[model samples]
Structure formats: C-alpha cells, structure tokens
Target: MAILTPGKPPRATSRSRSDARTRFSDRASAWLNHPMADIVLVLTASGLLLALGSIMVWSASTVFSYTQFSDAFYFMRRHLVFLGVALVAGWVTSRIPVDRLRGLGWLVFSVAGLLLALTFTPLGYGVGGNNNWLNLGGANSMLRVQPAEFAKLAIVVWGSAVLANKRRLLDQPKHLLVPFLPFSLLLIGLVVLQHDLGTAILLGGLVVAVLWCVGAPLRVLGTLAVLIAGALGTLVLANRSRVDRILGFLNPGSDLTGINHQPMQALYGLATGGWWGVGLGSSRQKWGSLAEAHTDYVLAIIGEELGLVGTLVVLLLFVILGYAGVRIALRSSTFFGRLVAAGVTSWIMMQALVNVMVVLGLLPVLGVPLPLVSYGGSALLANVMALGVLVACARDEPDAKAWLKRRATLRSKAPKRRFSAVLPGRS
Candidate 1:
C-alpha cells in the first residue's frame, strides 16, 4: 500500500502475480499450437471406441459363448485379454522412431509376405471357408493366427515408407511402381489365394490410398486402379461364393433362406431394433437368427440392442478418429510421418466404412471385421499398433519438438547453490 523506495525491489506479491500471469499466457499459447492437441484428440477418440467395443462385444457374444462354451463371458474375457496386449503394444510402438520404421519397410513387407505364403501349407487352417488362418499351436490346436489382418498394417507402414522416400520423384511412374506395386500385388494375390476377397480388396485400397497421399502421378494411380479393379473382378468371378453374394446383393428378393440368409438376417435385426432397440441382452436375433453377431456383424447387433442411437455413436466415433488422423497428417513435418499418418488412417477408415456398408447391405459381405470394435485378436492388435504409430508421429511433429526442447531446458536448469549450512574447507 505504501510507495516503494527508488532503489528498492518491487513487492514480492506483485512480482509473483505478474510472473504467474506470464507463465499462464505462455502455457496457453503453447497448448494452442502444440502438436499434442491433435494427438489428444486421436487418443480420446480411440479410447471411446475401445471402451464401447468392450461393452458391445460382451453383449453380442454372450449368447454365442453360452451355447459353444457354456460360459457367457468366454469371448468377452478373451477380448479383454487381447485388448490389454494390444494397448501395451501400441504404447511401445509409439515410442519407436519413425526413421527406424522407415528403414524396416522392406523387412516388414517381406515378413508379411512370408506369413501369407505360409497359409498354403499343411499348417493352414480354413475357417468360414477361407484358408486364411495360420495354425501355430501344438496338436491340441490351442492357438490360431490371422496373417491377413497383420498384412494390412504391414502394407500401410511399408508402402508409405516407400512412397515417402520418393516424395520428390513421384512424378515418375517407375518410382511409384517399383517395389510398392510388385510387393502389394504379391500380397493381395496371396490373400485372395487364401480365399479372402475382403482383405484383398482392403490391400488394393491401401496401395491406392498411400500412393495418392504421397502425390503419385495421376497416370500411375489410374493404371494401378484399373489393374486392381480388374483383378478383383476376376477373383470374384472365379469364386462361386463371392458371385452368389454379388448376385444376392443385386437381387434382394432372391433366396432369402439360402445364400442370402446371413445378409437378410442382419437386415432383419436392424429393422427389429427400430429406434431405441430391443434393450441390451434382450435381442431376439442374437439367440439363433444372426451368425457372426460378435464379429463382422457386431454393428448390426448394436443396432438391434442399443438401437439407432448406439449405432450413430459408433459412427460418430469413427468420424472423429478419421478427422483427427487427417489433422495429424497435415501437421506432421517429416515426410515419413506424413505418409504413415495418411496410410494408417486410410486403411482403418476404409475398412470401417466397408464393414458398415456391408452391414447396411450397400456392399457385398466382404467379411471385414469392424476395426477396434469387433472381437478379433489380430485385427485389434494391428489397429492399436497403427494408432500407436500415429501417436508417435504426433509426438515428433514440429511443435512437439519445440515443446520437448522447452521441457528439457527446464529440467536442465541448476538449482541455486546453498552453502549457509556448510563451512568452507571444513573437511
């Protein structure tokens, strides 16, 4: 309250207030411009989807579990276990350097190729008519692995790494086609050979998406697009089951009790839910009406149980995730990070859209599981890892570097020396 002497220091309270305000303003500006803002959005959206998946998986799988294993929580328990493993893997993967990942592109691609090739051996286990699952367990058959699911992540990481390396040389078709084209084609061919049309389609989509994001010449993208479409069409024609699904899609009135049973039942479940749904654990269709209710068609089960509201919430979460992913890609400074962010985002979003379209009868049943939401170990693990990579990109973004530098400086500052308690040369 009194006037300060001319040579005296300002009041301690006044100095503290001013310092606090300055610090607050600095932090506010930093947060507004920080790369972590986008990453927070990504993690928040992922957490929401994962939490929702846990609840829906439990609800949808209870009936199926009870009949098969005499325990309603069997699938739920297994899914939680997988979820734990995936989250940890994602965190660890996020800590790895993007440069290292870029360097391992070809190696990762080769391993994925090897796994796909192994599907043709005697150790291959065919499920749901697709010889795509690898049998890696003992004679008791305690473990099963899906190589196709892992292939999605591998293609995105490896493919984007290749494209990012040639970012400036992308005008040349040779640069675009060299390793990415050949390796991508081989992997897609292997997945199709295993009778998995859905994964093959996703792989094809992944190539186009990555190349396009990396600014590949239009001529190159167009040529690959046509070739991919032709290959898919040919594969569809060669497979009787896929042809039937296409026919069933074209003619909804055909054979409700035959090849179309699954799709029709899925539709029936959705229609029965109407607005608010039949209530959790009260779905009539899940008892015996709809098969694969816990996997590919879990969205339909959600519609039937939690109604249109729940389904919309799931859709909204995907949209939020996609938006955050795009933002992250845009904010990334490194070519490798930018390419990876786009590639992973496209694969996950495209797969989710495909699953939803199939559930809604807009597309043929491709047997693609809903990412992060459906109950599949390999798919969940791949998705979490992909998101982990996204987090890493966000962490290394231009602004993130600045933030980290500031933090390092703070930690490096030496505390003021206190010698009052020590006598000089006492020892």
Candidate 2:
C-alpha cells in the first residue's frame, strides 16, 4: 500500500506567464523601437511594385515605343524620370507634418479645380478622344498633365477636411448631401465632358466611399447612389458610342467586325495565353492583334505571355498592396492621415480593378490604365505620387516608433555639429 507518488512539476501561474510575456514584449519593443516598421514595409513594398512595374513596362512597351518614336526605350526613360521626381517629392512630404497637409488640402482642391476649368480653354490638349490634359509649354512642349489626377488627390484631402469639420452632422443627410453632392458632381461633369467616363465613374465611387467611411447614414448614401446610377445610365444612353461599348461588353463575340472588336480580341489574347503563357515577349497578341496592348489592355498582354499564373501574380500583388494600404490607414493616428491614405489606396486600386475587369470582359471597356504597370506618362507619375502619400502616412504611424527614434537621434547629432562652430571651435 505504500508506494509514494513522484513529486509533480509545478504548474505555471498567470503571474509567471504574464511576467514572461512582459519580458518578451519588452525585448520585442526594444527591437522595434529602432525604426518605423510601417514606413519601412510600405517603402519596401512600393519599391518592389515600382521595380516590377518598370521591368514590365519595358517589356510591355518595347515594341510600341520603338515603332511610335523610333526610340526603343522612350516610354521607359520617361517613366524613370517621373519615378525619380515622385520619390523626391514623397520623401519631402513625409518630413512635413500631417497638420500642415490639412491646410494645403483646400488650397490644392481650389487650384486643381481651376486647372480643371482651364482644360476646357485653348491651353488644353485632346488625347485619344479625351480633352483632359494641359499643355505646359517648354522643352516638354507636348508635355501633357491631367488635372483630373491632381483633382483625385485633392478630393482626398478636401473630403477628409470636410468630413472632419462636419463630424457631428454627418448623420444628417441634408448637411452631408448638400455640400458633397454639388462639389462632387461638378468634378464628375467636367470629367464626363472630357469624354472620360472611366475617370468620372471612378471619382463618383471614391466620393461615395469617403463619405460613407466618415459616417454618412446608409439611407442617405443609398439614395444618392441610386440617383447617381440613374444619371450615369441616362448619360450613357444618350451617347451612341457609350451604348456600343455596353453592347460590346455584353456580347463581344457577336460584333467582332464592329463595336466588339477590342474586347473580342482581348478575350482571344487571354485564351491564347492558356495556363503557363507563351513566355515573356512572345505574345502574338501584342503583334498588332490587340489595340493598346501596352496600356489599357496590358493585362491581356500579360495573360498572353505570362499565362494564368502570371495574371494571378498580378492580382496577388494588387491584393497585397491593398492589404498594406488598409493597414496603414487603420494605423494612422490622425483622421486626415487615415482618410488620405485610404482614399489614395482606393483610387489606385479601383482604377486597376476597372482596367482588369474591362480587359477580362467582366465590365464595360472604359479606358483606364493598369496603375504602375500600365504604359502612360501621366498615369505613371500621378500614381507614384499617390503612393508617396501612402508612404508618408505609414512612416508617421505609431508602430514606426523605432524608426522615428533613429531619425531623432540623427537630428540631434547633426544639430550639435552646427552649434560647435559658433562656440569658438578649433575651426
């Protein structure tokens, strides 16, 4: 009867585990306290996207750029220049306070609105049937700038400020609808006049998202959305070409010789791409089979050469980008910063969605570039600049405490050198 039980191991208590966790967390925090985490990740992702985009741009545009300009790398070179400028601008912007950005929002909106108005004047240039570009005279005589691009960015800033200012009254439909409806419609009308139904629709969605996120009532948003949808439907019906596009989308196979040619060809390109793709630079579709193969229809070219896998990769990159953007927006401390980051992310991502959807026959073809991967000077620069804003917001986030500490250290050390010379230094 007298077998003695072996002594049992002591169980871990909540206090002991809590202490261990606290110690582990302290160590982790120490590591993270060296540089901004969100900023580094954002910058890294952005750089990856940009680098991949550049390579793909060259691949996408080599034939077209060569044929159109007699220079094999014209578009690529131009894109590089824009990339450099945007990077500088973004870095500078990151150093500035978000509060300052709030002040600039209204000014930016007003200035961009003016520029949009100027596009209707003689100074404007019509490109590919859309008169939405301004000709800034110089060595870049043909240098065209799309005011709508700036307007989108401005809308983010202005909308954030508007929402912040009216936080209390957001639930009141009258106050919310009265100011936003007219301001938003003015921009949409101007874009529609430019014959850019894509941008117009994109802007409309953006305004609605911003308004909703800021706490606009569901009924108010729903009613306005229906009205906007009806108005847009009427506008499309009024235009014969718009009707043709919608029809073409619905039945690409039926109108091969007429309105449905582009979408039909795009679909064919996708089919030929099969599973693994024909291999890079070997797309028969790019050989004049599909129009605008490097720009609006680049996804088709991707499918043609890179296959389903490559297409999926592109989609995955976008998904990752969207996730990162939303992460940054959520982490942002200030309302303006959060909205700005969210709006820019949504703007670029939505455009990418429209481009892919149109190419894949899921939506009506409205000419929109595929963000960074598409070949277009205006689109490329504008998009990079928008990404820059996202980077700035990420850099300022709370998790970036480590990175901010390093920056502070560097600032302190740098300033000591400046004052050393004034204190009767050896030099």
Candidate 3:
C-alpha cells in the first residue's frame, strides 16, 4: 500500500477513460439496434435539419432579399411557405402504403417525364445558364418549377419497381437494359438538353443504385460506370463555363475575380467562422460578399455563423439520416422497399457530398444545393418527400411493423376516459 499525498487528488487512469468510452459505445449500439430506432432516427434527424435550414436560410438571405425585394423577410417567408408544402408532402407520402407506391411507379414516371418535356416549350426559361425551369405564370410570378428535381424522385420509384419485378432477370444484360436504360436515358437526355448536368449526374447515379440493389453483374455495373464517367467528361469539356470552373478549381489563385470569386468568398466565410463561429445571423460574407448565399453557398453561411461546430452538426445529422436510410434498406421485407431505400439514400448522400465538397473547394462549383438545407422550393420538396418514403420503408420492416402493431393493439385495448373523469364534475 502507498501513502497518498495530502490534499492531492488521484489522477484518472487512461484505462478508466477507455472503459467509459466502450460502455457508452455499447449503450448507443444497443439502443440503435432496437426495432423502432430507424424510424425514430430518421424523423429526429430530418426534423433537426429542417429547423436548422429554416434558420440559416433566413440568416443568409436577408441581405439579398432586402436588396432585391425591399423586404428583408421576403426569402424567409417564401422559404417557410415551401417548407409548409414539403411537410404536407412528406406526411402524405409517409402514410402511403409502400406496396402501393410500387404500383404508382409508372404513373409518377410519366408525370415527371411530361413535366420535363414542358421545359422545352415556350413556358421554359433559363436561370444561371441552365434552361431547367418552367414558369407557370408570368416571369414575375413565384410559380417557377424545376422538373429535373421531380425527375430524381421518379427515377428512384420507377427504377426500384422495375428492377424488383425483374430481379431474377437482372443477370441478363438484355433484361437489365431494355426499358430501364431507354427510359432513364431519355430522362437524362432531357435534363442535359436543359443544361442541368448536376441533376443529370444524380439521375444516372439513381440508375446505378437500383441496379446494384438488385444484384446486377459486376461487369455490367463496371461498364455502366465507365460510360457514365466518359459522358460526364464529354459534357464538362463541351461547356466553356464548366471548363473554366475546372481550371479555377485546379488553380484557385489564377482567377480571383471571375470563376473563383464565389468559391474564394465562401472559403473566407468558413475561415472567419473559426471554431465557435461568429454567431448566428452575424455573417459578414452574407452581406453581399458571397453569391447565392441562400442556395448554393448556404453551407458557407452556416459555417460563418455557427462555426466549425455548426457545420459539423449539420454533417452529423446527414450521417444519421444516411445511417437510418441504409438500415431501413437492409431491414426492408420487399425488394421494392430495398431498392427505394438504397436509391434515395445514395441520391441524397451523394448530392450532399457534392455540395459540401464544392463549399470546401475540393471540387469545381456544380451549382448543386445542399439537400433539405438549400433555399430552393423544388429541392426541399423532393428531399423531404423522399425522406417520407424512406420512413414508410422503415415502417414496412417486419420488426418495425410488429412493434407498431403491438403499440396499436395496446392503445386500442386500453380503457378510454372522458375529460369529465379528470375534472371534479363527474365520473
């Protein structure tokens, strides 16, 4: 036995700390493995992101909104309206039977296709050099819609249904490529014609996701990947603006005021944010230094206002969402559910990755917005609705369904009481 020094505290051992961490990890893993965990996690994460997004959008768009519309809350009000619509869509989608969605695959696909075709009519107009918006009313109206955004959802639903139905035949190239390839190619071609390469890439990725979920042959997947890469390269080279962006990404110092301006300002915002950030709604860059502060560079504003901690929170929420999505896919009882879960997971995660990478200057600016967090009405609607679908798939899991049924039975069997029972009036 050793004598302890007077008034001196014993030091905590490294082994003790390690043991504590292990115990916490075990607890977390066990909780997350529960039958209801996926649905809970999805709802929690999605809700937090939506709330944070609304706050950040208002913060980032104030200056721009005031400058253009004379009302500082203009963008924020419009964003709230879109959020309301998205929430309604999500609620409706979550209530839809997963199997019914499979039957609706073709109809949804047809509607998306028709909308895309409408983008070629006189009602279509270009924004930021991408002719992807269809104006329902005059130019001054706020009814502009992006068909490509909806096409992303359509591809997931339709592709999953088709692949699941032909699951056994996916081994053969003919069965795999016949209708799926032609339809997907048509959609991508339409998007490309609208000059929306980013959405086009997302659509192509959805195809790969569905095929992979159905266990397409490795050779077939490899060939498709190569073709997609080649097509992307060709498209990049064909656009002079895209070429300049690539150059700017490679040599950021070469063009400080042109292609590199927005990205450089974004970096400055991030750098200024430091660790804790400058504080919410206190970003210096959003005052007009950063372009598209409410849309493309909203992440930068988040960084500037909330600091690295804020940005990390956003990233963590997405990771949680992705984890729940993948878990749902794995636990889903049907092939259609699996494909939809995987496809939507890949789509949202990939898009978020691209947006983050662009803000971090790791990739050229591709004009893609952060999902669920960006200020675009169409993107927000599509994302939340996809998440609702994901939640429905989660609920379709055998374990989740049983758990839900048990809860429902318990509630129904419980005795009902009137408000008078709790009041002093009567029993």
Clashes of 2: 6
TM-score of 3: 0.94
Rank ordering of all candidates by TM-score, starting from the highest: 3, 1, 2
Clash pairs of candidate 2? 33-402, 34-402, 35-402, 35-403, 36-400, 36-403
| TM-score quality measure for candidate 1 | 0.87
> What TM-score would every model get versus the actual structure?
0.87, 0.84, 0.94
Candidate 2 has a TM-score of 0.84
lDDT of 3 by residue, 317-398 (tens): 9999999899999999998999999999998999999999999999888889999999999999999999999999999999
- Sort by lDDT, top down from the best: 3, 1, 2
In model 2, the runs with Cα more than 4 Å from the true position are: 1-35, 138-142, 401-403, 410-427
**Highest TM-score: which candidate?**
3
Cα deviation in Å at residue 20, candidate 3? Answer: 3.4
Using TM-score as the yardstick, the better of models 2 and 3 is 3
* lDDT, residue 287, model 2: 61
lDDT of 1 by residue, 1-427 (tens): 7688999986778878999999999997786566578788789889999998999899989999999989999999989989999999999989888888788888878888888888899878888999998889875343677889888888888888887787777777787678888888888888988888889899899988988898877887788889888888888899888899899899987998887888888998898898899998778777877888989999999899889998898999999899878988988888889989998899889999999999999998889999999999889998999999999888878887788788879888957677766678886
Please, what is the whole-model Cα lDDT of each candidate in the order they appear?
A: 0.87, 0.78, 0.92
Worst-scoring 10-residue span by lDDT in model 1: 137-146
Question: Model 2, range 117-181, lDDT digits (tens) per residue?
Answer: 98999888787788998988864553778888777877887777766666677667777766766
Candidate 1 residues lying further than 4 Å off, grouped into runs, are 1-34, 138-142, 408-427
Shift in Å, residue 241, candidate 2: 0.6
The prediction achieving the highest lDDT against the true structure is 3
